[model samples]
Target: EVKAIHYHPENTICDCCQCQMTEIGTTIVREEAEFIPARMEKVQHIEHAYECKNCKADLSQKAQIKRGKSPQPPIQRSIAGPSVLAKVIYDKFVQYLPLYRQVKEWERYGLNTNDKNLSNWVIRASHDWLLPIYERMKNIMLEKSILHVDETYGQIINRSDGKSGQSNAYNWVYRSVPCQGPTIVLFQSSLSRARSVLEGFIEDYSGTIVCDGYSAYDKIEGITFANCWAHVRRYWLKADSKNGRIGVKYCDELFRLEREFKHLSPSKRRKKRQKHSKPLVDEFLAWVENSPFYGKNALAKAAEYTLNRANGLKAFLDDGRIEIDNNPAENAIRPNVIGRKNWLFSVSEAGAKANAICLSIAETAKANGVDFYQYLVKLLRDLPNLDIHRNPEIINNYLPWSKTIQAECVK
Candidate 1:
């Protein structure tokens, strides 16, 4: 319970009747919804200096002054304590509460904090502590042989630090396939949805990528691409066909077989697909080449989409480890897209990068069964003291999927 209170009526004169009223047993005990103000406090750190008397007595030498050491502030020169800073970071990143909205909440509770100060705290924390963990997650995620890639638009402020004039930017997401060891999701913020962005992010990634019909994913060399069946269905489902029966039926059939194959081992699933799915695909392609829906209408568009992406759409038949769709990447980034509607925009590239780092860590932790709140609290409180630049190997222990984090953070 947050708190409790008792009420008692007094014996006093009635307001309008001007008569003495006697206290008696309660007729109705009322308990309604209420709230208690958040507990906020102010703290100060003072460093005391001491000088050696022997050193001071030597006039030819400079006085030796030693200052007592204190732990570094959560953000250098910021008054926000670790817990307070951690709460705000969690609120903005995980809960999707915008900084201005948080400012309003704090003002209602009578605190003097503002958005600028809170944003600075978040910026410092992201750059100083979280990016190393994010990079480590990137390295770990790339090791998977099969991954999913997807992109969603994120709004950034106009002329963001003069980095770009574009109002909308890309939040590219990549994640490992299900039933794979230690699931992870990684997000990268970019000024443009260029092919180079994916290339640079992938570096030398030589694995299967399950994605949609985007031309950008096609440019990345030396990687097998498995396209999403959902994209194919969306086109056919949206197309207003005069007789809504034939062209899109194959997509439905494939999905039905997938549902049955889900519980089977990958090798068994692959053999099943080869035996059952391949013939249906052959018939579908033959129909597409000879069908009457060959005009440039919606039906034609649907067929053309499949025919154009035939290789990618059918690549899943070759490997059981590859999921038939890019749904995992889409599902992981869906919350970030929803939160974008509330927070609306990032003011600078620094803030956009910060947003990506926080969302990546939070979602990845949650995907692997770790509670994001506790994980982030531990990160904010402890990560500041590590000397990562000097000893890069120290970051391996801090990764979300590492043995230490798995033991401590997994729910």
Candidate 2:
């Protein structure tokens, strides 16, 4: 609130020898920010029935009755509205607030709910409305010519294979290069981190993939693999010796040159790398190959790792569009890792899949610079009205980069 004070004409006279006060510019006295706690509201939809008065009076024909249609709920016969469901998911996935903690928060807002009910709402909403969007994003991401891939471990309370609840499951992430295509980050959950998992996602894809030094990616036949130099740098850092310091210097030089070429076009970047970065790469590889590290020490291990992925480490030099590291995929997968620290393992296989679906939607929304909560609310409130099943192409409009989504959900 703002209150302005003015001098009254009657009070303009001075006490003894006074004159009318001259006008002066206003000044800000004080300012402070306030916080308004969240609150909940209940909405009721009432449908009225009516009968034709004339037909009833005539009594010759039966009176016809008409009823109003109530708007569809996200889930039938459920108290959760689109906004409520969006808040639940946004809290868990984006804010990393577990359902049990949110239970207390919801109580503060005048609602008494448990985590079990919250979990049910999330699983149902993801399966019903969000899965289609996830699938659509996967299809569009695969179409890109360049992608970044990485994986981290997740725990499941119950394994589908009848293993112990503590067994490790994998959360695989795939991200697109914004310079080459739309910004998309997709998370996939797998029971096993086998070569088959990699094959399934990039089935017939022959495009370039920027990844870490994971052997699973090496077995794929038709794809071009550009390994991360950041991982190579990590290896040298672990060596912790004079030789390791020298290796670090070489790696740092390449990165410094890349920073200089950051804004260049693909073709120009490739040209600059060939002229400036290629020689440094060649010299580093030769030094690693001939370095006299006796046993399987850290220095020797670093040399072996670099020599093993020599082709991949040099892959970035040939294409300016390919990133020097898989940092994008790593950054995209970090949220799921953090959330796991809070909620721990998922209870069932379906629950695990639901986690992946929500993560994909949340991360993709963020990557495209959209407000995550707004995007979720928009999808839940609007998607049901669109006929995406009959015409699958209709989902393209809701993708994070689409013009419609940009106009409505971008921050």
Winning model by lDDT: 2
lDDT by residue (233-347, candidate 2, tens digit) is 9999999989999999999999999999999999999999999999999999999888786589899889988999999999999998998999999999999889999989888
Model 1 misplacement above 4 A = 1-36, 45-68, 158-166, 242-244
Q: Clashing residue pairs, candidate 2?
A: none
- The candidate maximizing TM-score is 2
Could you tell me which 10 consecutive residues in candidate 2 have the lowest summed lDDT? 2-11
lDDT at position 303, candidate 1: 81
Global Cα RMSD, each model = 5.3, 3.1
Candidate 1 local lDDT, 182-299, one digit each (tens): 7888889888788888999999998899998888989577798899988988888878674335656778899899999999988999999999988988888787767766788888
TM-score of structure candidate 1: 0.84
